[model samples]
Target: MDQVNIEHTPPAVVEYLALRQIAGLSPMSREGAEIGLPNSLFAVCLREEDMLVGMGRVIGDGGCFFQVVDIAVHPDEQGKGYGKLIMSEIMKYLKENVPARALVSLLADVPADRLYAPFGFEYTSPKSEGMWWRQGE
Candidate 1:
């Protein structure tokens, strides 16, 4: 996968949201309609000739913390460093805008944590924990 173009589009924010809905792992979907919208979070996608190959984003409170969510690369594009690309882009944004020691977090899914670790994302184990609020009963 050579020559991937990463675009930070304001109007295309919905792409990341839609992809998350497809991935079906984030709290946004479980949180229901009032909570999740097209642009509630900041998003970025990797495109190779107009096709969305990968994406990730930072969501949550601007003052206290942020969650790195929606990290996904299309099935056909996986194992090609696309995941790292997405992580790098998202981390870059956080580094530039977030204040020092502002607690940037992400819920790693199994082996995916390997990619995130090198980007300075540590497991919140021993000192802390990670949990979620699921929807419905």
Candidate 2:
């Protein structure tokens, strides 16, 4: 945790996919990452001695809608406050760049949901529920 450096850039596609798998997030295709990572509104990569140990990203239209996504940390690196570190950089970007009317959102996988709360993210349920449709279901 001492020497982990924060880079305000997305991880390489290979590191992105590998970290997602190790962190237990749903798999994303390499093609998708190649297209998506460069389109990030903002991204943070936490590296210890140049090895990516954690990352997060914001993706959306420049003004209207933005989503906080791909929050992942290598299993060996979790619980050392790296997730919070990633989110902190993300929140800084949002505060500086996003308009007040722009909506920022994320789907939190439980327990991890706790990590997002202090950053001011909240549930949009009952009033509005989260639903999804997969490409090849």
Candidate 3:
């Protein structure tokens, strides 16, 4: 594995879609990406020589509530610490920017919960559960 460069730049919609599909994440429509990405409070992208191999973003109302989302890395590039790289940058942003007592959350996908534990993310079940409502559903 070559050296990967992580940048505080959001991925373009095309690269975002490609990374999500390759990472086995659900797809997001182009219009959705266009509207949502620009609203990110902070975003990081990992590049290996010019390829967008990994990305993550923090989105929310930008003060009291924030969510860590869109964490993805190319399948071929997994296990190379790219996810950690992305998370580290995102965490740094959160720690520096978000106020104390602010609520930060993320929907950890099964096994990926382990990835977030070190960053102070814990299960919010039993007392409260994570839920979402799809647009047409």
Best-performing candidate as measured by lDDT: 2
Instruction: Write one digit per residue (lDDT tens) for candidate 3, span 1-137.
Output: 56988789789989998889889998889899999888899999999899998999999998899999999988888898888888889988998999989999998898887899887888987989999977751
Candidate 2 lDDT tens digits, 12-106 = 99999999999999999999999999999899999989789999999999798999999999999988999999999999999999997889988
Show model 2 residue runs off by greater than 4 Å. none
| lDDT of model 1 at position 133 | 77
Ranking by TM-score: 2, 3, 1
lDDT of model 3 at position 67 = 92
- What local lDDT does model 3 show for residue 127? 89
TM-scores of the models, in the order given = 0.79, 0.96, 0.96
Regarding TM-score, does 1 or 3 come out ahead?
3
Q: Global CA lDDT of candidate 3, please? A: 0.89
Model 1 segments beyond 4 Å from truth? Answer: 10-41
Between prediction 1 and prediction 2, the one with superior TM-score is: 2
For model 3 the local lDDT of residue 91 reads 86
Q: Which model is ahead, 1 or 3, in terms of lDDT?
A: 3
Error of 2 at 81 (Å): 0.5
Q: After best superposition, candidate 1 residue 56: deviation in angstroms?
A: 0.3
